[model samples]
Target: MNNYEKVLVALRRVIRATDLHSKRLSKNAGLTGPQLLIMRTIRDLGEVTIGTIADKVSLSQATVTTILDRLEHRNLVYRVRSTQDKRKVHAHLTEDGADILARAPEPLQEEFIGKFQSLHEWEQSMIIASLQRVANMMDADDIDASPVLDVGAVLREDGWKETKKKAGA
Candidate 1:
């Protein structure tokens, strides 16, 4: 296979692994991957704004708002308008939300964190560096306050170019 095709195959494996893990996490914890991630962020940051949550979760503002809507409708969180700023809405966990957060599952697909924690510090660092290097080779950028750089972003940019060539981004 060509280099690009080989890379595509490897990416498919990564994506499939993530999907499988998300499904398992959902089945075991009753929370989707993204929901669990948001819960953990809320637990860590206490009261936080939607924009902060979006940045923390590596999602677009609009996407985070939609997730927050679902979370709010499920009574997992509450939105409070800032008394000082009025226009600022901060999301706070409810009692139920807190309980849920306390029991929330791990964010990583596998018990990678647990396993990594068990490794020697140097070993862990090496593995992380290797993975990060691979990610960099794939052109994945840092998530927060940086450019988007997942397969989705690559696809979007390339798709736009292809479409423009065909018709007109």
Candidate 2:
């Protein structure tokens, strides 16, 4: 195969791996990558606000708020206005949220990061440069994306239904 074909295959493999992990996360924890991430951040931060969660997770506050809405609807999280500062609402995980989060599989990037960190510094730099070049080549450098690696919408509850519909499935 040509070098370009090989590159495409590698990219496809990466995407497929993310997709598979996403499915497993949904199946095992009933949470999307972003949802899982937001919950984890809330648990870790304890007294987090929507803005705090958004900043911690590298997502927009609006996106975080939407995800929180869904999570709140499911009884996995709750929000309360602080008496001292009613304008700033704090997010907290419910007992059910903590229970599910405790059992949720680690995000795919956790494993990737562990392995990436084990690489030599120079090798890491090279990999980063190459990936950046690829992004530039694909004209995706300007895209607004958080650190979440899951495929599809960050917190779409329906999973792949939209993709399937688009594909005429």
Candidate 3:
């Protein structure tokens, strides 16, 4: 194949890998990537505000609130208005949430991060630059994105439903 075809193939593989991992996570852990991420953040931060969780996860507060609402519906998390400040609410993982999180597989990015970090600094920079160039070439350089590596409309509460519909699942 030509170099450009090779690049396209590599990008497709990355997307497919992310899609497959997301499916596995949803099947095994019963949580989407963003859901697990938000829950884990709440667990780690110990009664964190939605804004704080949003900052920690590199997602918008509105997106975080949506995910939290779903989690709350599932009884995985609960929020309480701070007594010291009624306007500020804190999120805490319910017992079920913590239990599910403990059993959930590690996020796909965590595994990638470990391997990426092992490479030489120059290699890391080259990879970053190359990916940035690819993004620019595709006119996706200015798109809003977060650190979450999940595929689909991760910003929406019904994102997975839309993905499934697109795939005719």
Candidate 4:
């Protein structure tokens, strides 16, 4: 294959790895990456507001709220209204939350982050620069993204089909 084809294949493998990991997490833990992330944040922060969790995780409040709603429904988290400021809501982890968290698999980035951080400063900077350049080359530099490794966090129930329909409409 040509250089371009080789690059494409390598990229696909990386993407596919992420996709497969996401599927495994969903099947095994019944939690999306963002959900696990929010759970961990809640556990770490004690009683934190939705905005705080969103800021900590680099996710939008709306997205966090949506996932929090699901997590709350699952009884993994509960929200309490602030007594002093009744309008304020805070997230709290439940017993089940703590138990599940103790068993959840290492995050998708756990291995990657460890190895990436072990590289020398010069090598780290070079990788970051190269990755940024590749993102720009692919016209994805400014896309809203979180540090979470889960791909298609925004997709739900064949979002692609709906997007295709809208594009052709």
Candidate 5:
């Protein structure tokens, strides 16, 4: 196959694997990858502001706030209007949040991160450069991507409902 086709196939594999893992995480633990990530961040950072969580996860504050809304609806977390600074909001994990976190799967990036970190510095740099080059070639440099590994676009798309229903069944 041509290099472009090969790269597409590889990217497809990576995307599918990520989606499957996210599905497993949700089915088994009732938490999306991003939800689990926010929970873990709150746990690690200890009652931090929404901006802090956004910064920690490399997600925009609005995206973080939206997810926090979902999480709050599910009673996994609560937001407190900071007394010291009324404009600042802090996120705190509920008991249920802590328990879910205890049972949650590893972050989707954990394995990839471990292996990536094990590579030589030069190899790591080469991979980063190559991936960025591919992204540029695909005209994806302007996309608002985050480190959250749940395949958010696919998950939110029209077909995702049918796909998720079938997967859940």
Candidate 6:
């Protein structure tokens, strides 16, 4: 195969791997990949509006609303109208939702995170940088790029921070 075709094939493989992992996660956790992602987003950003969730998850607002509808119907989540802004609705996890979220299995793709962590620091940086370059070549927008890739920083317990210490504040 030509160089371009080979690259396309590799990209397709990565996409397929992601899809397969999501399906496995759904079967094991009783939550689809997107649902679990949304729950985690809600946990991180409490009482978030639908638009905010959509933005955080890189999904369209309508898609998030549909997922929220299912979550609400399952009694895993509930929406409350903002008292000061009647037109705004914020989504919060119900007790049942929290319970489910607590028990939900990690995504199969997360295995990659563990493996990535096992690699040498330089190896990890190289892999991430290569992926970021590939993403840029594919015409992914600047906003869609991961901060971790852009800044060469890891999401530590304290949050996203540069790996290298700056000379001064």
Error of 4 at 7 (Å): 1.8
Give Cα-based local distance difference scores for all models. Answer: 0.67, 0.88, 0.88, 0.82, 0.83, 0.69
In model 4, what is the error at residue 90, expressed in angstroms?
Answer: 1.0
**Clash pairs, model 4 backbone:** none
C-alpha RMSD between model 2 and the true structure: 4.8
Candidate number with the higher TM-score (2 or 4):
2
Q: How many times do residue backbones clash in model 4?
A: 0
Against the hidden true structure, what lDDT does model 1 obtain?
Answer: 0.67
Report the CA-based lDDT of candidate 5 relative to the real structure: 0.83
TM-score, ranked from best to worst: 3, 2, 5, 4, 1, 6
TM-score (all chains, Cα) for each model: 0.61, 0.90, 0.91, 0.86, 0.86, 0.60
Candidate 4 ranges with C-alpha deviation above 4 Å: 155-169
Please state the error at residue 92 of candidate 1 in Å.
0.9
Q: Model 3: per-residue lDDT, tens digit, 56-149?
A: 9887787788889989999999999999999999999999999999999999999999999999999999999999999899976546677788
lDDT-sorted candidate list, best first: 3, 2, 5, 4, 6, 1
| Clashes within 3 Å, all models in order | 0, 0, 0, 0, 0, 0
Per-residue accuracy of model 2 over 10-122 as CA lDDT, tens digit each: 99999999999999999999999999999999999998899999898887787788889999999999999998998999999999999999999999988999999999999
Error of 6 at 30 (Å): 1.8
Give one digit per residue, the lDDT tens place, for model 4 in 1-169.
9988987898899899998988888877788888888999999889899999989977778778888888889999999999999888999999998888887876788789999999999999998997788888997654656788887864442333444555563
- Scanning candidate 1 in windows of ten residues, the lowest lDDT window is 145-154
CA deviation > 4 Å runs, candidate 6: 1-9, 107-169
